[model samples]
Target: MRYIISYVSTVNPNISNSDMTALMDYVRLNNNAIGLMGILIYSEGNFFQILEGEEQTVKMMFEKIRKDYRHHNIIKMLDKEIISSSFSESRSSFTVISDHYNQSELHQFLKKEEEHNPEHYKSISYLAQKFMKFN
Candidate 1:
């Protein structure tokens, strides 16, 4: 079954841009190899991620993320068995909200989804919208 897990965490204050890029690169590569697909959004030292994959694989990844020192106060916002993967691309996507162009584009994309699927676009979608607005 396909599972979706959404979580938020504060980025360690000391991590630099280059470090964040490297960290995301590692995550994307690993996730791709393991059949995971999702989008990771970083904004103002906070991370909002949505991962979709097999139950055990996604759970195992969440556990590793919980122990990672690069972030703290990890709070899972959503965990549900979904009908299909929202992101089915080969590799996981990463977006740093500092880039206004990309950030706005993502926000628009989610907003469109929210309008079309109001029921499924609940708390997680709201939280993503709010996270995108963070400076």
Candidate 2:
């Protein structure tokens, strides 16, 4: 079965731009090899990510991500089986919202998401829509 997991974490303030770029590159390569698709968004000092793939594979990845030292306060917002991946065309996509304009836009989009459907897959779709808009 397909599964999707969405979580938010506080990013380490000390990590530099180059470090973040390298980290995303590593994630893309590894996720592509493992048949995962997702989008990772970093805004200010927070990270919001949604990962979709085979059930067991996604679970194992989440375990490793939970232990990674680059972030803290990892709170899962959604975890459930899904009909399909919202990002099937890409291995992984990332967006770093550095400007105030895009950050505000993303914040509004997330707030709207909360008022929409509560289904896991739908939430993932909404997140992908917003991610594509900003990135």
**How accurate locally is residue 134 in candidate 1, as Cα lDDT from 0 to 100?**
45
RMSD for each of the candidates: 3.4, 6.1
The lowest-lDDT stretch of 10 consecutive residues in candidate 1 is 91-100
Give the per-residue lDDT digits (tens) of candidate 1, residues 67-91. Answer: 9999899999889898866653432
- TM-score versus the correct structure, for each prediction: 0.75, 0.67
Cα misplacement distance, residue 135 of candidate 2 (Å):
13
lDDT of 2: 0.69
Q: lDDT of each structure?
A: 0.74, 0.69
Best lDDT among the predictions, by candidate number: 1
lDDT per residue for candidate 2 within 46-94, as digits (tens), equals 7778778889999999999999889899999889998755553432433
Q: Which stretches of candidate 1 lie over 4 Å from their true place?
A: 88-101, 108-119, 122-124
Candidate 2 at 89: error in angstroms?
5.9
